[model samples]
Target: MILTDIVSRIYVLNLPERKDRKKEIEHALKQIGIHWQANQVICWPAIRPSSNNNFPSVGAYGCFLSHVAALQDACHAEHGWALILEDDAVFASDFNTQLPELAKVLSSEQADLIYLGHCHVASETAAPAGLNISTAAVIGAQGYLVRIAYLATLLPYLEACISRPAGHPLGGRLHYDGALSLFRQFNPSCRTWIAQPSWIEQRFSRSDIQAHWWYDRWPLLRQCAAWARKFKQARRHAATLN
Candidate 1:
C-alpha cells in the first residue's frame, strides 16, 4: 500500500523546555521500525514567546502556531496531508500500518478529524468496523492526524484564534480546547476511532507557571478536578451504554 496515499506525512510539535524530547521520540520511532525520515516530518524550533507579547503566551499557542506554520511550510514544500504529533507521545508498534487504514476510512467517510485514540461518551455508538470516533479528546498532541484540505480550511481560523486565549493561565501551544470548540462549531461530530490502547504519555514539564500553581500548590485540587472530569465522562458513556 502506498502509505502516502492514505496520509502523506507525520510530525511533532515540541516545547522549548524539553530539548531532548524530540530526539528521544525520534529514537523510539526508529526502534519501532517506523522510518520517520522516509516519511515527511518537519521539526520546528520550540516556542519561547518573549514577555512582550499581547498575552502571557505561556501555553502551546506559539507551539500550535509553529505546528501549523510547519504544516503549511511542508505542504507548500511537498504538498499533502500532514499528521501532527507531540514530542511526549509514544506510538504503538503498528502505528504506520494503522495510518493508511485510518486514512482510507476517513476519506471514505469524509471526516474532518480522525482521532487515533481518545476519551469518549459511554454510549456504545457503532463506529465503522476497524475504526470508530467520538466527541472525546484524543491525547491529541500525542499523534494528531490532519487532512491537507482540512488543514488548509482550519489554518486561517486557527491562526486567527491562536492568540485569543494568550496570556491567560490556560494559554499555550496546541490549543486543544480552542481547537475542540472550533471542531464542534464547524463540523458535526463524526467517527474518530479510539486507539485500542491509548498512546502512552511521557513526563513533560508545563511551562505555564499557573499550571505549576494548580498542580504543585494544590495537588489535591488538581487530582479532584481530573477525577471529576473523568467521572463525568464515564457517567455519560455509561448512560449511553444503558
Candidate 2:
C-alpha cells in the first residue's frame, strides 16, 4: 500500500440535520475492517441567528467548517491519517480493491497529497485526467484520504474567517479554497486531480446556498479574492505577450 506506514482512520463531520446521515456513514465504516471509536465522529450544531434576531439560530455549514478544523487536529494528535466524509456520500464496489494500487501509485510517485477517491467524470462517457505526472495524481476531496502531517498546518485557521459570499446575505460558503490555500502554503507547488471512475454525488449549486450559523466565510472569501487577483495577473501577462 502507498501508505501502509500510515494508519487509516475515518471520521464524519456532522450537524443536527445529519443524524441519519451519520448512521449511514457509520454503517459503511463498520462493513469495512475499520473499528469505530465513539469520539472519532464529532458533531457540532449549526446555529446562526436568523435575520429576525429573535428566533433560535439554524445553519449547518458553519458547524461543518468547525468540525473540519477539529478533525484535522484530531488526526494530527493521533498520529494517524484521516478520511473525512459528509453524511450524504456513498461508496461503490472496488473501493477497497483500489486502495492498495492507489497507495502504491502514491508511494512510487512520492505524492504529497492523496485526494482519496472521486469520480472525475460524472457521466459514463468521460475519462479522468488531471494528474500532473507519475509522482502526483490530482484528485478531489470527495472521499479524501488526508495525510495528517500535511494537514496540521491549516487546522487553527479553519474555524475563523469563513462567511457568506459577498452581496448574498443568505449564501453558502466553504473552506475548500482556504484548505487549498494551506496546501499551497505548506507545499508551494501543489498538484491535484479527481481520483477517477467514482465520485460523491452532492447537489450542485443549482439551488441557492443554504444559510448556516457557524460556517466560516471570510477565509474562503479571501481565498476567492486571491484567486481572482492571480487570474487577472495571468490575463495581463497573456495580453502583454499578445
- Candidate 2 segments whose C-alpha is farther than 4 A from its true place: 1-6, 33-35, 38-60, 78-80, 105-109, 117-140, 156-188, 191-193, 199-242
| Candidate 2 residue-wise lDDT, 1-242, digit = tens | 22233445555555555465566656655545444455544333322233422111223344335446555555645544566665544454335555665655555534444555443423344445433222232323445555566565545444332443422332224334334434444454444334554433321211112442232247676456546654764564455345
Candidate 1 C-alpha lDDT tens digits along 123-209:
445455345555544333455556566665656666655665453333323355346445544555433445444433332333332
RMSD of 2: 13.8
lDDT of the structure predicted as candidate 2: 0.44
Most accurate candidate by lDDT? 1
Poorest stretch of ten by lDDT in candidate 2: 200-209
